[model samples]
Target chain A: MTDAPAPGRGWVAVVGLGPGDPRYLTPSAAAILAEAEDLIGYFPYVARVPERPGLVRHASDNRVEVERAAHALALAAAGRRVAVVSGGDPGVFAMAAALFEALEAGDPAWRRLTITVEPGITAMLAAAARVGAPLGGDFCAISLSDNLKPWEVVTARLEAVLRAGLVVALYNPISRARPWQLGAALRLAAEHRGSETPVVLARAVGRDDESVRVLPLAEAADAPADMATLVIIGAESTRLIPREGATPYVYTPRSVEAAR
Target chain B: MTDAPAPGRGWVAVVGLGPGDPRYLTPSAAAILAEAEDLIGYFPYVARVPERPGLVRHASDNRVEVERAAHALALAAAGRRVAVVSGGDPGVFAMAAALFEALEAGDPAWRRLTITVEPGITAMLAAAARVGAPLGGDFCAISLSDNLKPWEVVTARLEAVLRAGLVVALYNPISRARPWQLGAALRLAAEHRGSETPVVLARAVGRDDESVRVLPLAEAADAPADMATLVIIGAESTRLIPREGATPYVYTPRSVEAAR
Candidate 1:
């Protein structure tokens, strides 16, 4: 067989940097970043990456995901390996959705580019791990961002997931302009689950100021949650395991009987 | 501030290597491995690490978790920085559990050991990320191994998580000797969720020959799942999005319209 003609040059790897720490970055993500000539991502997220030689950084505003996606596509079309980075798992409420949308809608040249979304330790996973194994069953992630969607629709899905007994990982649960939605979400969740189904509030996970609190579902609504917090609502079998000399953590499906 | 202990000694960062691939290893994990003088883990998992000098390897069998934990604790207790490794995220179904269990049960002399479990990409997280984000909402993770716990208790937790309407990430769902339990899990999930809720069967995630299939919950009982497969039961809003070049993926909340 004839030798392959360099196997189509334009390729992009959408890497997820995880929540707030550099340590959670996947090895493949680092490898791809080290090789890529250009990197595109949100401003705050872009700032997280260390300055490297020969790397061109293109930081964009939060609302400019579409433009960022276009820039990545343009770089890839120019035969440069471009990386569109996101803080958490790129596929979940991050860059992949916008990238795919922009790529599909924009120039035809990008259609030939190979796009790969390199996974990262998402905030939810990091938060869940820090507390306990609450993500131990049927769960769904919902974003409370109504900028692109309607509030009614969001509540409907939330209600369905809640009513169906799926554990919920709420992203964009509360932003500066959208504080009320979180309360609405908690109410929806409480309508189905008991007021006491463990709710883990994790803030700045894997970061210096990391704080974790295992509270009831009702109390979670009143907590000081911000953009950095990832809320994990446990299922019915969740229990508070009190470890000596350590902060209390919530573990789901406790095996007390099995251990005995 | 007491100088933070000179940046090295008494600091042990035990990491998870994930399922079975070097690529699955996170950058932080690689960094820890690169710095570790003595690396400890299960035998099969220890063999998975790339060959390197300046590192000592401690391999144990399935029955020696407590011993391994004690050994690592001893080394740390003696001020020797060590890396206690495990397959999958250390915090999820791996060394972290055993480490904490040993800590809770061991003599008080070892109680002061400063042990940190650096989370790796768990098999279920890797699997869920590979699929279309089935873990977007409230989800639960359960292990089917009755080795440590009774099957009756496991089943109860499964049913509890199911009734809570959370997505389920099943670990140890099946094995060579125990295959029927997964079917039972599927049946239980189907009882709570609609027949159309997506169920992803991901096997050997992040490794060569990784296979991912999306089916309805009703059909999950007959899906080609095994011990290696991580079964993810999607939430009610999870939809199957089919693309030409890309494989069909399960996307939960179905974009902004449903996200709202």
Candidate 2:
């Protein structure tokens, strides 16, 4: 076992909360949260965290200042066990980057604290598992959010995934202002992946009203997808396997031809 | 929660024993084993299963007669709560298919039993997780064992994974008789994946003395791999993302130039 570092230096465990279900929560994650003195996260994710006595909760706006990031580091520096919580796995598209950004500012005090990322079930994995392995084979994940980078960069990556024949897992595919982006993404996908390539829409997976819709890529683009939906575009090899009573799951053949 | 089906008519739960670690067993799976009256599996897998009173263990050789499959099904049909166990995930390259084959030939009386596959932490996921998110995007799991299929079939699948740039998780990559297949697979990968494409060699993942080696795809192919190893090939977008004081973890960019 990897030895735990000496205690009392304020540490942060960036934990993945899993795909929105408490039952899916790993016992290790649960135990960490129960023992944490504080939880810091985006407001919606903070709300999802179960309330426990003696836990100080810090919630911030969707996009906040670097100072907010520093505040988390400061809390941990103050000798409190803190969990910088993220809804899905924290390492993938979550707090790990921002955490480093804060520490990189070269604060002498912050350098002394230990930080670790506890793996959680990523949304892509959870969505793929729910939909029946559409993730089989080369795949790419692209967020439709142009908030962080130029739209040009996003469009370029989309083209790369297509040329590489990589399945695409679209995160932030659609938000209030980004409705047209999803339509545009579909158009790009249609250029390479057949219009009939299976698209899985996993909305609010592992929660009430969980919806897993499987259709061709053409139809999924027109579906009522939102920020909460994770879109998986299967390669030519992925097939819809109909189970007797359960949801239709996608399976990619070990052979690429089997996907067709 | 899905209701537990009654046990009178007989039931088979194809359970994944996980990567040689008892702690990785899911709570639901553990509960089912505790209630099972019989455990039928290949000898090694049967040995891995926990012992309890009232539970009879039946183990068959790897090359056992086909009737052993029928016998297991018939025993379960005789009102025994049976668990057909396999290492890693039972559904992935394991007992689910064999169990189904036996059930297909059994008397109609066996149809009344509910067959449930309790997912275990597959070697692919466990190995991938240990190495950084090599499976962060689209991927496929292909068994290099050509015992059942022709080598040509396996070669074709490797080509597809390469042409499509899918992160490929390899199972049974090398065995005593077919030690050279792993080298052949690597040569194919070198031709397709960039020479620097990350490869993860996870030997006996999740087991004691589990060793994880991260290297370029070319370096990994000739490395001393065995049947116990799970090899993960990175997609074009996969990269080494370094975190503070930790080993570099693999990540595939959500957006690749090919997709955009």
Candidate 3:
């Protein structure tokens, strides 16, 4: 076994915790968490890691990603093993960007610390798996929350993706702060796709409260989605095939021959 | 522990092996593989798993995905626990779609058999993690090969994604059979994005041969990319930050204030 690193040689790992399911966590991520001397993230994500004697958890409120990233960078620069955890894959609208931002603007010495990103099962992947691979072909993931980008940007991207005839996955589709965004997105999608286009709403995927619903685009605006939900709008060739005595399976075929 | 199902109650699982690294495999995938009575996939992917007693391996040529999928489905229908393996996340231009296609056209009783898809770390996610988080914002994943779709469809989707100002990840960017596709795609992207926009090419990610190169979009066409490569064209907000003694880190900021 390798010994602990020498002082001033600390490293930081930005890890995805994988949608609230320990089983969904990759072995590489779990190993990194086990070796971490400090864990930093938003309160709910940080709390997911069990308490340990040598591990110091730095939990903060949401919307403070920059501050948390800076703290993790500082700890790593000082020779501590740090893990900055995010609920889904860190590179997908998570802490990975924040860490890179801090690294870019921080002191030059901060760049000396070793950093590695461990990919986890992102929410879209988990949700797709649950609903029978609705993202089986070309797809785009767009976050509907206007907290970071302007509403115009989101709308433009949504329209472009829809017109391109690619499956679309919407994250943060509806939040307490952005209640009407999902409806607006649905309306925008309806302009490009037919009313019969399939939409899958997967909430709290891989968790005890997990629920999945499949509906046509016409009725998708009424889906019970919130901050924890992922909305997948199917492509033109997407199919909802019914199974005997089981919920229908949704999938976008590999070939585009059936697409308009 | 749950007992194994009797004859005629077998199941099928489409599993992603995760971009060539066993460590990138999820525990759920590993567990499913351990219980698999038959393993079926393309030759290279099937060779990735070790041999064991009472386990049969079915390896086939690369382009016969439909035939291979049908074979796996037939095995599962015959009461065998079958696993269909793919290199990246099976849902993304992989075996998941093929399996679903086979299920859609096969015997109706085939739908009665259980099927589970275990998501593995997809190549784009692994590549994005390797080069920091260039996919931090909204992004689209498109397969550059035209084997399954018309060339016009790929070009149209590429242009749309570029115009939408979202990061674009191109899988199957180049192969010996299709060497001109990447250059054609680069030309199309150049028409939309600035010459200085960053492009990241990650080859054989999560393996010993892994290499990540970040360059301006103008020079992206010259980068060495093959079937194993994933090319990420950054959005307007993507930044490449240099370190004193190491390669620069590339990332797209979470906010879209800098996006065009």
Candidate 4:
């Protein structure tokens, strides 16, 4: 096992706290956070770490990921342990990439320090668990935000994934500024998926306000969703098993009929 | 915030132990496992859980997922708390689907028992963290094994995902009996991705034997790999950041220039 570098050895660990709940956080993440002298992340995420003496929090506004990452690396280069935190698995559309980008462009000395990226439960996986294993087989995760990539790329990725019959997880489904994007995505999914295909709208997954709904793609278009929502669009084989009292469990079986 | 059922209320929890590392296991998974009266899983996975005084371990051979699920469900129906373990996130190509399939097909009484699926770090995520974030942007995960699905489907998914310029994570990349599939997949990846595009082959991720390598698509085809290895083929935007003494970091830029 790769233990966290000994204290005073200056290392930067990009750790994922998992979706909102403390219980989803890995023991490794907790231990690494405890060892870090400084924690850096988007404001909401860094705030999740409880206050402790000798631990300084550098919470920044959204869209400053590169700056935050560079700051963390610089701290490590100066011989201070730092943890750059993210809400979900840092490698998936999160801080690890930003950290690496920053480290590549920043001071050469930073490369000498140890760096670790600890994986945690990402939203799609947590949301899938709360319901059932809709992502049991092949799947793709796409971020709908056009801030980084062109909006056309998002549309292309969705259509391709849909055509491939892979279950899809849509991250940042709505941009508060552009609510129509979710409707467009839901419509696109309907076109590529079967008429009776299921769609999952999960909001604030793993948190107290967690809500998960499985419905036909048509109805999902009108569902209320914010940036925090993680939307899962099922493949041709996805199914739901109704229960007497609870909402049905939805899962895609492992086996598939070979297409002729 | 769905809490595990009270001790007296029998329940079944399908949990992911996070790619063979104890540190990657979630606190929620650990707690549920601790509360379980019976632990059921494939031989290697069930053995991962220490022998507790009250917990009975039911370790079975592989390919018996359905039977194990039914066994767990039956025990829970009989008022016994049970934990069904998987090596990675149970929702991703693991026990959660089997459990739900069993619950749907088996005795109706299983529906009355409380059931929860606890998310854990899947191999791809853990493997991504081991290197830099090759999955930092849009990505798709496809299982190379045609045991459950048609081999043609695997080819179609790879081509589509590759054409869409999304990073790809290949699970069960090579079966012991069909080793040539890895070479074919690598060749297909080379066809779609740029020759210089980075590809990560991570084996036994998060375990003591963990080995991660990043190379061009052409070289990866001949690299020895097995079902236990998770192969990540980078998107066109994926890049490698050179470090003086360490292996270069690999990551996909969060942004993609619009395709004209």
Candidate 5:
């Protein structure tokens, strides 16, 4: 770095840190972070960024995304190089949308500021990799947390996607406030798919303690899960191959029969 | 460097190179590529890896994924440290599924070999980042190609997802053999949603010549697209903001009304 970013010309980059592993962080995001003078995000996500000289960190609570986003924009509007970092791909149920929601409702000047959204390896992709290619075909990702949307809407979308027979990746499967949503979601899935359908439960993927398990849909409602867990409910074509000494391989074939 | 890898003990790692940018390749994937003795993939993807003295490249034509996968498996079974590389994510309509298809149908002994699938920044994610957080809410991905699946199934899945009002990310939208599919998909989406719905077209994201544009669903069917393009059809809540001298930002709000 030669000279510091000048005042009155700040920009904001909403970047993803990629699940929980530094190794999954894109070099593009890393370079941007290296040049950022300020970082803004939720407390734990902000804590993930290493502290350094001349860089300020703004940590806020989880549900206050709009407030935090407005703060980031106000800083950037004053010409501070800023980055709003998220644990996974910011565009996928992360900070990018929140930032945009704030931007559209905030000052029009914020719209003129340079903004970039950087992609990352989201948790579902990381989870799918640890298992086999369970999402090789058509797929959809739905968040089980009804904090933003009504629970009825969540189930409606879930049932619609399930009936379509697309492989589904469920995020925020279970949290403190919502203990039984995953079970309900699983039961709903089993109604449209076969009982022997493969359900991939992946927790903390890309972390040291990552756990990925594939079970039949019949047995998944009672499976353990947490807020960080990502569940992939496979289509009818999804298959599981039991390995002799390792976890089974689950994959959805690229081809489907004409009869379907 | 350490001694050469011994025969009969070599393993295969299916890894993604991300979407055309070296910076998008995760450190985990880079490390794996660095250790690979043999790289197998489509010609374009295989050519992306820089040639070295000890590294062997096995590039083949497109549509030969299964053949290429079997070749990789045979090579790995002979104790060659092989990497089945795919552009974007290997698990998303890429090599990982093909490799598994071959594994299950190939020799029984191949199941014992250790296999690892490394995730990458897929094209849809990269494309979404280049534009805006069009995928901020629930979303689904569908391939337009009918090579493996029938066109009826493609439309059936497309209509199902569109009826659910989730953001739809269309991959392999158009190609030589399937030049008219993207238009068909846009038309199908228009049937389920308003013609004024936002459609984000991102081409070759993360590449030097990347192009991202936001338009209405009415204009997207005629919009220029190719195999490298990814089209995201927004839901009812998707909003677009026009900037003074830049492309419009498109994003779906995180929340849905209770009435929805």
Candidate 6:
């Protein structure tokens, strides 16, 4: 069935599924997914797409992004419409970069295949939206996993982000293999930020099991920092507004002058 | 019409429209817009929404974010479903911050109103998707406009981003009133990055006049840097791959070890 395609040139699309929520997916991404003949991604993300007769799903284990990317590229080169799916915005710590890496090193013929990336709602953005806007001001996103980068690099960047007084969003803060990284990163952050700094723990944002918790940095050490969680540490000017008989709202103001 | 009785409770949704393209707008944002009785935003953004008898559009000039946010809050407080629209993800340098500011300082009663933020495809994400994924790894986004902050803050952050070797995305790089800011920011970036570093100039992304240009850091200074343009400066690991009969694809590999 895959060999039947001769209607148009084969193409590859690296698409973001947007934090496990169908509502967060962009129209462009949905259209591309509908047209794809082959879908490749991590097992959990690939399971999100409904089974269809014409589409073939290739699910792989985590930590094998490069190999999956190569498979998608090869399929596209053979005149198949292939889609590489990621849970969040593919550009942010996801499959888009891996796809490009494979394309740059693979057969030059793979470079000729039409490729495009369709952006989706990243985890941080979805998490921020769910809990008011903790990332409303100048903020930086850093991944805490040291599988690809050194621990020193992450620490140095954390220090720089803290010194600059920018709101910080930590992705992959902790995993089964690295249980202590989140605590260590928070200690580094606490060194520069005040104890009163607000921290938001948004787990499984936009998903069925989603949960959100807002606390001061002093208490954030006890919050969950699992693979599916996003940690947003507020800047000095961030505020937490408690209301009567309702959950409090957390946000960082717009103007630096106003913040001061 | 303003005095209508409360049907349930008044609410405000600060929504992102996604870099001027309707397709980039998320399904969640679209649903919120459809239910909004009033919409408020900067002129260009408000103009994007279709005209409808039930929807009252309040278009204001630029730099009045605080006032516009206040207006939306007031309408919502008076039993109206108000949608405050922004061009990109509201949490990233957009209306979300302004709305929070207004809510914090406005009437105490305003705090009781239901308010939610709907994330959209931010400009950087859209621009990054256009060219390959230059933001695939650790990255930081900084606004070049110094209207709310000191110029030194922008320069200092640029230096920090460069020193940390993170991919950088510059928003609001230049406007008629700040034509020299983009050049100065690029000069600061060039001091840290090599002349061969790739830069992406994404102008009016997702709009009718959208144009994307990829060039080396040395040549990027000559490209247009208006308010509508987003400048992406690649990290040391970023690579530009040129293909036959196709635009070059630029992406930062996922593995930091490969970057070294």
TM-score of each: 0.75, 0.71, 0.96, 0.95, 0.97, 0.97
Q: In model 6 chain B, which range of ten residues has the least summed lDDT?
A: B1-10
**Location of the lowest summed lDDT over 10 successive residues in candidate 1 chain B:** B1-10
lDDT of 5 by residue, B1-260 (tens): 46466667788999999999999999999999999999999988999998888999889999999998899888888888999999999999899999999999998988988889999999889988887799999999998889999998888888888877799999989998888889988998888899899998898887888888888999999989988888899998999988887888888999988753
Give a tens-digit lDDT track for model 6, residues A1-260.
Answer: 54596624789999999998899989999999999999999999999998888889999999999999999998888788999999989999999999999998898888878999999999899999887888877788899999989888888888888888788999999999999999999888899999999999999998999888888999998886689999999999899988877557889986676323
The top-ranked prediction according to TM-score is: 5
Off by over 4 Å in 3: A1-7, A258-260, B1-6, B258-260
Query: Which residue pairs overlap in candidate 6's backbone?
Result: none
- By TM-score, the candidates rank as 5, 6, 3, 4, 1, 2
User: Native-contact fraction for each model?
Assistant: 0.27, 0.01, 0.83, 0.95, 0.90, 0.78
lDDT against true structure, model 6: 0.89
Worst 10 residues of 5 chain A by lDDT: A1-10
Which candidate, 1 or 6, would have the higher lDDT against the true structure?
6
Interface RMSD of each: 5.3, 6.0, 1.6, 1.0, 1.0, 2.2
Model 3, residue B53: distance off in Å is: 1.0
Decreasing lDDT order of the candidates: 5, 3, 6, 4, 1, 2
DockQ-based class of model 2: incorrect
lDDT of 2 by residue, A1-260 (tens): 22232346578776667677765455556777877778888887788887776788998876663556688788777777888887766645666555655665647667667666555556776676554445544355566777665677666666655654556778878888777888888888888888888888889876787888888887877899888888887766666655566665565543333222
The iRMS of model 2 comes to 6.0
* Candidate 5 lDDT score relative to the true structure: 0.91
Residue by residue across B1-260, what tens digits does model 1's lDDT show?
Answer: 43233323654566778767787677778887887767888887787877776667888877577678778777766666788888787756676656655555666666555566666777766776665455654456677777666777667766666654456788878887786988988888888889988888899887777898888888879988786788888766666655567666565542444331
Candidate 3 lDDT tens digits, A1-260: 25454657689999999878888888889999999989999988899898887788899988898888999988888788999999989999899999999898887888888988999889899989886879988999999989999999999999999999999999989888899999999999999999999999999998889998889999999877899999999998899878777668899998876335
Question: For each predicted model, how many residue pairs clash, with residues at least 3 apart or on different chains?
Answer: 33, 30, 0, 0, 1, 0
Ranking by DockQ: 5, 4, 3, 6, 1, 2
Per-residue lDDT over B1-260 for candidate 6, one digit per residue giving the tens place of the 0 to 100 score: 66463844779999999988898999999999999989999989999999887788899999999999899888888888999999999989998988888888898889888899999999999999999999988898899888988888888878887888889999999999999988898888899999989999999989999999988998898887688999999998899999776568999987775224
Whole-model lDDT, model 4: 0.89
